[model samples]
Target: MSIKSFAAKIFAGYIRKKIDNWASRPVEVQEKVFRKLIKKGRSTKFGKDHDFLNISNHKEFAEKVPVRDYEELRFYVDKMVAGEPDILWPGKPLYYAKTSGTTSGAKYIPLTRDSMPTHIEAARNAILCYIAETGNSRFVDGKMIFLQGSPEMEEKNGVKLGRLSGIVAHYVPAYLQRNRLPSWETNCIEDWESKVDAIVEETRNENMTVISGIPSWVQMYFENLKARTGKPVGELFPNFNLFIYGGVNYEPYRAKFENLIGRKVDSIELFPASEGFFAFQDKQNEKGMLLQLNSGIFYEFIKADEFFEEKPKRLTIGEVETGVNYVLIISSTAGLWAYNIGDTVQFTSLSPYRVIVSGRIKHFISAFGEHVIAKEVEEAMQEATSSTGARITEFSVAPQITPEGDELPYHEWFIEFEKEPENMDVFRDVLDKTLQEQNSYYFDLIEGKILQKLKISTMPANGFQDYMRSIGKLGGQNKLPRLSNDRKIAEQLEKIKKQ
Candidate 1:
């Protein structure tokens, strides 16, 4: 390894120690860390000046910064596309990571060399820890496959050559570069749609040991692969050993993924966003994901119940609590200060600071006049599954409001599961009861019968992938969107309905 690569590892180890120490403390100790966070918020320039951009400092400032949706970032990204310097950050960003925001409206998120190191450190450190935990240094000698997004895309200001995954590929340490799946497209492709066929073709015959990408997309890619090879996926790529996934949950497609490949492969979850990489599964127990908070960014959390309307109690690395879900806010080297990434997670145990991501707070339905958050949905789903002895592989709940004459006024679920319920009527009743007991809104809806019926659409095995594939969004960073609240989301639903 070069000096930089060697140094990165050493720095990662040091940061890991701090995280472990903080995670292991008592609840009181964790509370103390929040006090320190308030002090730091006052000192940082990025934390204080950019009112709209910075939110983590909400506790210190009486007038909290406004939450910006993706459109607000679009103008800044357009400026970056125009080759403008120091628009969003203090210095010039390297380029943008083109991503599908809320629509087909592709967004080019600004990324600078200074900002990128955080992503590198967080991701690389997670990889190193995984190797240490699993004793799987085979990555050092074996080839790895990354199911990346479009290698390129057109920016809002008309500049091309914007691809976050490709840019990351460009900056990775050289020693590891040789072990990657060979792709000249990684260097040349500038628009995402232009290279889909080539990317699919590149993996046809390789000694692939690891596969990394979003669950839905990876499933779609292999489904396509099976069509091309005219053989079971196992026969086409027998050497594949592991599946590394992030950006979305993998529970829904787990059984299908194993069955398709015809071998038991290690599965890992990575929690990353457009801002930077945040956490990864430490080990394979389905326990808690280890966070790389200090590696690349400054991290804090707000109480789950504390919306922006209320004063959010921010927690530092040391000041987190177990069982209570908190919202994540981060300040990164890229200059995002107190940025709320809209994720809700809770600590399982502190010793190592293992956390379980509950889900997105913004992605829940609050119809029937009761506020139903993502955490409640997850718990109710779990309860329903346990009671029925049925495992839900994948499920999504869309909240809908109907007119007075309409029958169902609350919500609907499009669920994909491995086995059909033995007694359909009993299964539905059990699930509805579980939700009603777990959440007040659900219970109210059932008691009043205001939401007349709950519709459950059972999908074919691996059906979620088909949904994602139809939209051309299949890779890491492309999530199975939880609650489709926007108007366009309805259109997407109609497409699925037609399909």
Candidate 2:
């Protein structure tokens, strides 16, 4: 083995041992994090206003600080943005991660001096864990490409502001600096199409071994590469074997990706956000990402079904159970207290506190009392495609509450297929059956005749891409929702289909 690979193996072993030590004592580590966060929070303006000084434990803390989404917490965030000190965390934030907000125009999530390193560390440890498990540190010596946003920053009250990925780009370890692909000028291109073209040109002939990004954007890059070289990505970059991704589940895009690469590659899934780096896949054979219990964030879970109740019980790490979906609330060193990040997660393993990002709390279809989540739909799609030998490029689900003629309202699946199923009726049946098996409410609805079996509408080539482009969110950390309760997205897909 090369010198770099030999050193990587030693480092990976050390990191893996450290991770195992903490993962074994999940609740104890979390309690320590809680105490540290509370101590720091006591000094902030929000801490003072919320009576953080008097809070002694989780119960008191919960009572003192109600869970607040971005809109509810804007009062304090606005102060932080306006150059106020100690409004949320302590002192001014080091940076503000700018992201699109649903009701609020743009959210500026603070990244404090204490909290920023956790993001970088979590990402680094994920790779180390993979290397330790698989004994595959040779990828360390090869070129790596992280398709991401521009590193360009705008300042707000002395705080650097940019997309989370852009901010992270600045923190890539020194050792990997020479190995990282796409020159800085190419990454700074404002337009995603141009950026991808530049990236393709720059990295097409390089010895790329690891590529990281959201699956959709990476798919675009792969397509562009194939178009240019007339060869599958794996053939062009023989050393490429590790695929690291975050932001969205990669299962739905797996088939198309395998086809583009002409082979299967091992992948690491990450559960990260602007608020904090929460979890990363620590085991290649495991079912879920290892929850970052020792990170500088204290976690709270409200059962997703009861999330909207007047007062839902917030459970700590010690009180959670497997197979239950919960709204992930967090109080972090970043200065967010009882903050709702809007994502829902389910524990797949409690011994080491591993979790799967189940879906977004707001992104579900319950128009007919059948609460179907993103996980169920994605899994159903996976099962149907696997069974039928079909390859899908992208898809989204929405409730069709109104249907013409005598047909009952049903779920409308807008799907973009790379290889259409030979028997589409059979494909649709398998999709519907798999969803019903996973979600009992939907099963009940189907059995009671309240809703009909789901229908599929094949999207034209690049239909989803066109929709995203139209909305000005075509690339760089933006992903379409897997499902929506309302018809806003469904109606738009209809227009794209007709076109």
Candidate 3:
């Protein structure tokens, strides 16, 4: 590694020490520290310039800065794209993380230098906590795997276009960049046809120690790993020690991953988003996730009912309660004041500020732990239908829970298309297989109790799209809803099934 990269790791280690010192404190001390940090956040340069920072004190600030959603951030993004920073902070942002939207259409989440440290620090602490809990100290020694987007830069000389992941690669610590298993530029699975297959090939025989990234992608890798290697993951990489996953729940995907590896793997849940890393799983079981609040952003939580019923009421770390879900809001140096990230979480304990991701406030699915929030389910369906070599034009998923008499709840997938899916049965099987593999709870529930079927319907090619358009949701920032809470959606789907 270059001297600069080595220096970066040292700097990160210093930051980790400080995090440990603070985190090691009693709950009361942590709360006191949190208050001091909030006050400091209010006095920071970003707070001074923005009107949103006008609260008289931290207490008042927490009370007044209502919880916000992505829609609120979209307004700022619009201004940022137009070259207006809105005085929320100093300096221009680097780029936006292009993520799929839930209630809205596609979203371009802004990422800036000042705001990135939280993500960096949180990720680092997550590693530290994992080490603390697992007592396996060989973090830097083994091959690590990250299933993620291509790191290809978007544009070089304004000519060839690439991916955003590559751009962020430049900012990673040099040591990490070198140790990263898949070389960013050389190993991207750009050709849509060979993506999963290629990923499986890339991971084979690497003597991997750590694994990370989105659950869906990891599931794909494991499935293909089993196919190509003829051995489950545990047999293939006996040295694998830790599973670091985020971007979705680990519970639903846990059993299958363990089964693939053929052994128990220590795991950590991370809460990194395009914007920043908010919190990470605590080292102790039953201790809620620990928020890296002191790193880069100031956090505020809105009570569950208040967040839903009226303008959200923000609570500082001191006022937070145990076992109740709250909407997460952050004010970051990256120029966002009072930004509401869509996730909802519940605190399990206070001393360490441990929390669990409960659900999304809106536009997210609550069933199957598929992480099938509005956007992911849409993207997966689109990808599957397009790649299946079938003429499928539309689809939906309604989560159903059977009464207590039944063993498990069923997830009814509604499909509508002109022609029967070319390899209809195979496609259905693929869909079921993929969902179960991607979502652990779905897999476990299915194996244990729920015997859901892949329900298919034949409609005109545009039938589903036409219905979405009729609902006045065809255009900008909208999508046909999937993973509905009410059984009415399934009932409607059944009508289409019978048609």
Candidate 4:
């Protein structure tokens, strides 16, 4: 056996044993984790300010630390950025991961010595778990092409700063580094188009076994490779069998990715963020990812429906029920306390807890009294593609304001296509029909004459990327939103088209 495959076998075996032991008592494990986090951080500035010493249990802990978003925590984070050591954690963070999509454009989330290794371990376990379940390790024997940001990080207060993926890329297990490619210099190129070309040129004939990246960027790479070689990706890398992806929902680009690869391959999904690595797809039979209970994070859930209320009820790991939409609150070793990262999720299992992402708190559309989320948009988009045999490259939706003289507001979807459908009217109809079926408020609005059928506008192939680049959010961990309550994103797209 090849050395790489031999190493994978050992890694996979160890992960299986750990998974079996951890999966047995999910609640108990989480309680222990919370305790460890509290004890370890009780003396930090944030802990002292929040009265962490007085908190002995989850209830007191919850009462002491109210839920907060980045804005609320900005005071402490700003202090850290100015090099105030031990403001949040025990010492200064090793680096910061620059994230986007806030009112403030970009946010620098700390990457601490205590927290960075957790990110690495979660990724390692995600791969090993897949191998343990599928008995497929051949992919590990060859190189993996990770489409990540440039590792040419900037420094803020003596701490390195870059995209989270680039920082993690710098610290993956030494053994796996031997099987990974496209040199660091090429990855450091700031121009995405040039970087993609460099990646395509370097790895075209290599023994590629796995591909890991955001779906859209991967699509761009595949498009470039196909144009250069006049062949599908499967022909270029016959041994490739695994695709690991995250940072965006894969549903809209599912058919396009398959068409590019020329076959179905094993896929493992992860819910990773600058804040913490929360979940991963561990079982093929399961509907959602297993929530990592012992990952140095203390989790709280507030029902999404009540998230904006005067006082929403908070649920802990033991009290959480399946099928409830909850806004996840995390307090982790990264020095964040009861921080809301904006993503909402629904639990699918409780015994061995697992969850599926529902949508972003800020990205949902509720302008017309019809609450539509990323999950609904994605499912509707899938049905539309399947019924019409069309393929979408990227899409975003916004509520079209009702005219001053009219009571009906409709949805306008801006889409870029890989393969356009023969019948545009049918494609639009199926998409509207699926949304009506998925969301009751949306269905009521359409049926009661409160809303009109959704409209679809075709965008130029590169329109979305153009807008993203304009906003300095192209590539790396950046992702497009599925739905917006306002026309902010739609208006930007229109301007890009005009340009």
TM-score of each: 0.76, 0.99, 0.67, 0.97
Q: What is the lDDT of residue 398 in candidate 2?
A: 94
Runs in model 3 deviating more than 4 A are: 1-17, 24-54, 59-66, 155-168, 191-193, 284-287, 363-483, 486-499
The candidate 1 region of ten consecutive residues with least summed lDDT is 53-62
Badly placed stretches (over 4 Å) of model 1 are: 1-89, 103-108, 153-161, 186-200, 234-236, 308-311, 373-395, 403-410, 416-440, 447-453, 458-477, 485-492
1-499: candidate 4 lDDT, tens digit per residue = 7776777878798987887688788778878988888887787889889888888888898788889999899999999999998888988999999887467867889989888888998888988888888878888778898888877789998999988888988886777788888788888888888888999998998999999898988998999999999999988899988888987888788899889989877788899999999999888778889898878888999998899998788788889998777899998989888999999998898868889998998789999788888888999999999888899999999998954575477899999998999999999999999999889999999999888999888999889999889887777557888889999899999888777
Q: How well does model 1 score by local distance difference test?
A: 0.63
Query: Which 10-residue window in model 2 sums to the lowest lDDT?
Result: 490-499
**C-alpha lDDT of all candidate models, in order:** 0.63, 0.94, 0.60, 0.87
Report the Cα lDDT for residue 388, model 4: 84
Candidate 2 per-residue lDDT, tens place, 1-499, comes to 9999999999999999999999999878988999999999898899999998898899999998999999999999999999999999989999999999888689999999999999999999999999999999999999999999999999988999999999999999899999998888998998999999999999999999999999999999999999999999999999999999999989988998999999999999999899999999999999999999888999999999999999999999999999999999999999999999999999999888899999999999999988899999999999999999899989999998989998999999999999999999999999999999999999999999999999999998899999999999999689999999999999999988888
lDDT at 462, model 2: 90
Best by lDDT: 2
Candidate 3: minimum summed lDDT over ten consecutive residues — where?
155-164
